[model samples]
Target: MTGGPSRGARGGRAWREGHAAEWIAALWLMLKGYRILGFRLKSRAGEIDILARRGRVLAVVEVKRRKTMQAALAALTPHQTARLVAAAQQVVRGRKALQALEIRLDLVALAPGRFPRHRRGVGA
Candidate 1:
C-alpha cells in the first residue's frame, strides 16, 4: 500500500477542519459587528453553519474551507444553497422579532494562511 492516511483518518481530519473553519468564520463575523444567533443549527430544512444578525440584515452564513479560495467558494452547491436559505427562513418563521430583517445568504470562505473572505448577499 502507498503511504497515505486511512480513509477514516482523512474523514476525521476534514471534520476537524470544517469545525475550525466555522469558528474562524464566526469570529470574523463578530468582529464585523454581526451578532451570532446560532452555530451549526439543525432545522427541518438542513443544518445551518451559522446564523448572524447586524441591524436589519440577518445573515445565513455557510463556512467552507479548502486548499484554495476558489475551491472553498465552489464547496457550496446549489442544493446546499437552497437548504441554507430554507433553514434561514425557518429561523425567521419561528421568531417574530426577525420577521422584518432582510435574510442574506453569506459565504465565509477560508484557506490556509489567508484571512477569511466573507461575501454577503450571495443568494442571487
Candidate 2:
C-alpha cells in the first residue's frame, strides 16, 4: 500500500482537523436549529468557517482546532480577527436576505476528541 504520512503530512493533518471542526460545528448547529448557509466562506481578507442563520440573526463562525481554550484563544490573533470581521461584513453585504439581519460573530474552538466550546458575539 502507498499509505504514508509523507504525502504532505502537515497538510493532511490540517485538512483532517478542519473537516473534524466542520463536522462538529455542523452537528452542533443542527441540534440548535440553525440553518447552515455556508462553510469556509472566503473573501479578500480571510475565511469564515461557517455562516449560519437562526430566525433573523446571522452568525459568522470561526473554527479553531487546538488542544485547549488557551491555545484556541491565542490562535485568534488581532490581525486574524480583523480579517475575519472584514470577511464576515462582506458576506453580510452580499446577501440581500442578510442585509438587515442582526449579525453576530461566533468562535467554535475544539480539541481533538473533545466537544467544541462556542463563543458568541465576538467583535472586531
Question: lDDT per residue, candidate 1, 1-124, as tens digits?
Answer: 8689999999999899889999999999999999999899988999889999999999999999999998998888899889889998898899999999999999999999999999987776
Residue 12, model 1: lDDT of: 100
Best by TM-score: 1
TM-score of 2: 0.85
Global Cα lDDT for candidate 2: 0.81
Estimate every model's Cα lDDT from 0 to 1. Answer: 0.92, 0.81
lDDT by residue for model 2 (1-124), tens: 6676676887988898788788788788878888999988888778888998899888888888887766875576667778877898887888787898888878878776677777788663
